[model samples]
Target: MNDQHIVKSYDRDLEAIQATILKMGGLVEDAILLGSEALTARDIEAAERVRKGDKAIDALEEQINEEVARTIALRAPVSRDLRILLSVLRLAASLERIGDYAKNMAKRVTVLADTRGIEGADASLRRMAREVQGMLRDTLDAFVRRDAELAREVLARDESVDQMYNALFREILTFMLEDPRTITPAMHLHFIAKNLERMGDLVTNMAEQVIYFVTGEKPQEDRPKGDRTAYMGAP
Candidate 1:
């Protein structure tokens, strides 16, 4: 009876940690959307709000780490249980980095606000951000469901996000080359696009972590990357 009670307590503790992860994921999703929206709308106030909201995301990550540490110390979890806790740490770290990228996107909105607007650039960026946000949402779902297939699906979708970034990079470059006056804003837009692309990569990493925990091994296949900006000599 005592052993059963102890097992129940450990399960409750794990549940609480998972709940915190879900909460953090929700905040990250919001940050990605709001950051892109703020850029598109030229809403400095909204951008500031996104920036300030990152503190909460950061706090949740720290909370998760502490909770995981405490659970590990007290439970001495081994095997699958230990893997779950370690994966939680990796997931939290990835989410925190994504939040920082969102914040970086927000930080540039004000700078671009004053620069001459490039035609359709902001709208394109918003679409890219939305794609990344969707991937993140599904990745979180896969994590919660412990669905390795769903996680693999998320991995496959990352290539689309990279393609979007590649298209945006070319478009922004064309604008910069055509009009010297538009160069400043176009650079800022490129940076934001890069941030979104990086976020996609981070989401892919999280999905791989999910697959690792679920399957007891990383995916056997190499991840497909569609971003070609590096080869194109893009800054």
Candidate 2:
């Protein structure tokens, strides 16, 4: 009713939205950890839990979208406030996609568990997944702290994830060539590696959003990429 009351109401709405974002982020982070654990341990039950947990992440994304829209219509936020809401929307979308990648990784576990395990492949993938999970955590922290430098650090880490995938790609290729029997499992392993690489990229996207939110400008430097599987193909 009064101007003071309106300001307090808007503040409450913004806080609520941020709290939801963190809640959703926590779920995604857990999914990443659990999904990678399932893969490395060859635990089908853990993988199933990751798959079922995705439904909650999806619901949170929808809720964030609705709340953001409602906030915009009711409060008519301006300037930095609007920027934050917009950033939250983008962050939610990125987190949702990361969740999907995690879910996809879990889906492959069933097949991988049934087939013979590729030597060292799950270990490499789990390591990559762990790195991505760390990046995601840092990006969320950056968002909360409004730390552009930390977000940039998260972006820089993406190259390591790509390099890990490249290394695994060559290893799998060699395995396939060395033994015909390994081709099926190697292909599945490659897919999981690709999925983890993608999750890293999505985390980088989230980091970029944090940078933009803090500075109001996207980073000018080109993101370095190390994925080289395409070049290794038969010519």
Which has the greatest lDDT?
Answer: 1
Q: Check candidate 1 and list the clashing pairs.
A: none
For candidate 2, write residues 1-235 as lDDT tens digits.
9999998999899889989999999999999999999988888999999999999999999999999999999999899889989999999999999999999989888888878777888889989989999999999999989999999999889999999999899888888888888998888889989988988988888898889979998755666566777778841
What is the lDDT, from 0 to 100, of the residue 186 in candidate 2? 89
Report lDDT (CA) for all predictions.
0.92, 0.90
Write the residue-wise lDDT of candidate 1 on 26-49 in tens digits.
999999999999999989999999
Ten consecutive residues with minimal summed lDDT in candidate 2? 218-227
Candidate 2 clashing pairs, residues 3+ apart or interchain? none
Residue 224 in candidate 1 has what lDDT?
A: 61
Model 1 scores a C-alpha lDDT of 0.92
lDDT, candidate 1, at 185 = 90
Model 2, residue 116: what's the lDDT? Answer: 79
